[model samples]
Target: MRVVTMLHVEGELDQSRHAAIEHAVARAAGEVAGLRRSHLGRHYPGTVGGGQYTWDVLFDGRDPAALRQAPALLELVEEGALRLDTVAFERQHLSVPEPGIRDCVKRTLLLRVLPDTPPEAVERFERDMLGMPRYIDAIRNWAFSRADPELHPTPWTHVWEQEYRELRGLQEDYMLSPYHWGLVDGWYDPESPQRIVDTNLAHVYCPAATTILGWEA
Candidate 1:
């Protein structure tokens, strides 16, 4: 299973606290033998609430056991900074599926557009584009919504993650569909959405091997 840890700081995090936190994180990484690959990044300016800093640490492991030991690693950070509000989840068990471990291509895209637009409309658009009958077939998973309240640093915006599977059969079926469009633009409306701010896309690769830690349900 893959695990994602979200840490939100209540106020401006001091430099001292930041250093200690990073140090502890590094130490924990060293201690966890089962970690296959880990990535840590801070949320961009528009992604968090006012006067707060958010960071996400992602761990890819073979099994739940590997993630079970994650808290111990986080405890090290807590001991070092003592100034953070943290939440964690075994990604596969959480609301959002763990794209890192699933056999699919993972993509995270940040979209900032007009506010007050119902989420249903956005979801509908995505479904229409990705669900088209005549298009290259790809095992795809998509969701759209406003950013988490605690994580929305800016007003009137949100982020989304999309997953596509590279299955030859699916791809062939998509090609025969009438809705097939050669380019991504055929699906996503960059301007119609309006109020554009920022956009980003990432292609994620899932490692073949993983380690399981002692995790309790």
Candidate 2:
């Protein structure tokens, strides 16, 4: 299972403590049972629902032993130094496989689909999302999946993630794409009849020195 966690830091964490925090987290990652890979970094400029830092952990399975969070992270949360919003979802649809790029940007779209929306309409919305890469050449890789409520409950029902060569790929190619504005926009726009998603969403992206969303496992 792939666990994507976005944290809203309550205050400016002390610069002196930064290395300790990172080292603690890394140590925990190594000790954790099923954790295979992990990535932690500050989010980039273009963001919605607060800029926030992000943490991605890939687990071998849903075992309880593997799910334990780092002590440092728990301390921060317990001390009210950080706020968290996490989603655990399996990679369902993998379209546009990683283009073998080491330096890239990964963006995550976490949204809540209206519960009353017809299943057919929901399916159509998903199809529209998956079709975006076809029209936007800048998208290097992408993955879409429904969150597992049993594991972690949240208002967000789906996760749409994508990778790009740089911030421009998303700021320009993605935002300005005709298909994105013309067809896909309707599903999220309240004024449109096709609207099915709630306005509150977490659309954030950050720098990635190595593939996170593009990982095969």
Candidate 3:
């Protein structure tokens, strides 16, 4: 089973405290026997929502109990620097139902692109690239929206969220397949400009199971 834990921190956390927390987690990442990979990062400037810091940790284990034993993980930062006002964690167990095939699960990847050209040109380019036949199977559904001022400051940015059922070899296919050619062609527009913001990608593991940690009506 694979667990994806998302932690959101409220308020402005002290730098020293943040560093301490990161260090602790890094240590755990190295020592934990079941951890596969872990990522910790802060929200982009001008992002919406209250939580400014987010941490995503992935663990390959039978259950979440394996991660619960790491006491010193967040202790140092919690001592006097910051308090965890809110925490959102989720776990998804990985399974292969068939004899030779892995169970189909939902995985979402976020892509933030900044084109050197005009918004319309960029949109056209994306449509042409993603409209390719080879990519037709890889992309389940996608949406493009401008970064809201209340959500982010990146101008004319587009967010691509893609869902894949099976991605074992899709990464390579996406890089060298016909899809790449389409991207190159679309990027040839004269209006292409330098990107102002960094691109961020997050891998979220989705299973047949889910639980809501916090919600309000």
Candidate 4:
């Protein structure tokens, strides 16, 4: 039972507050059962998508109820440090070769399907998304979800996540993969108002330390 918690951060923050935020998150990580990995990342400035900073918490064999009660999460809420826009939890949906415990890069996408899109079409789109890894070998790990309104009441309905060994692979291999340009791109049109995608890439951080730094590799 893998669980991921995505926090959409808001409110004024300075360097001091930022450090405190990370500390709170780390404190929560220690208190939560099954929370083996955690990442607190700030999106690159001027990016066209995603939250300003995302707190990605990964838990194994933990329930969503327990996750909400995480000490760090509770502390943030109680202290008014976080103005959460969205909170989503998803289990592992697609299987790929595990990237193991090493440092890697990750891309997270928040998607919203047009209201006018047919239900059957939406279902088909999901099937195609799940099959993406078969065609793009650059993706080292992947997981995603079409949010359940009852559990995840966020405006976005779909969440896509993937890991890569290096950013170059993401750009040269995954982005240029025939499967992406030929098949996936056809399904998504930037010009179309019917669909929305907000993507952000970040260095992967585990319990032990921050990993996958530097852009040279």
| Candidate closer to the true structure by lDDT (higher is better), 1 or 4 | 4
The best-first sequence of candidates by lDDT reads 2, 4, 3, 1
Sorted on TM-score, highest at the top, how do the candidates line up? 2, 4, 3, 1
Whole-model Cα lDDT of every candidate shown, in order? 0.39, 0.80, 0.40, 0.59
Local accuracy of candidate 3 as per-residue lDDT tens digits, 1-217: 2233333444466786567666765775676686765554444343333234433344555444444345654553355433332121222111222222223323333334544547776557565644543454553333323433232222323333233345543354444566554454335333445233334433343331111111110
The predicted structure with the larger lDDT, 2 or 4, is 2
lDDT of 3: 0.40
Better of 2 and 3 by lDDT: 2
> Where does the lowest 10-residue lDDT sum fall in candidate 4?
208-217
- What residue runs in model 2 are displaced by over 4 Å at the alpha carbon? 13-21, 63-68
Tens digit of per-residue lDDT, candidate 2, span 92-184: 987657657678998888899998999999999998998998889899888889988777766789998888999999999999999999999
> How displaced is residue 68 in candidate 2, in Å?
5.8
Clash pairs, model 2 backbone:
none
RMSD of 3: 12.6
- Residue 176 lDDT (model 3): 56
Backbone clashes per model, in order? 21, 0, 7, 0
Candidate 4 lDDT over 1-217, as tens digits, reads 3334445455767788767767766787778777666666665444334545555665564354565567777867767666454445555375546635255666666667666677877877787788788888877677767665555456666767777776666668877988777666655766544333333232222221233111101
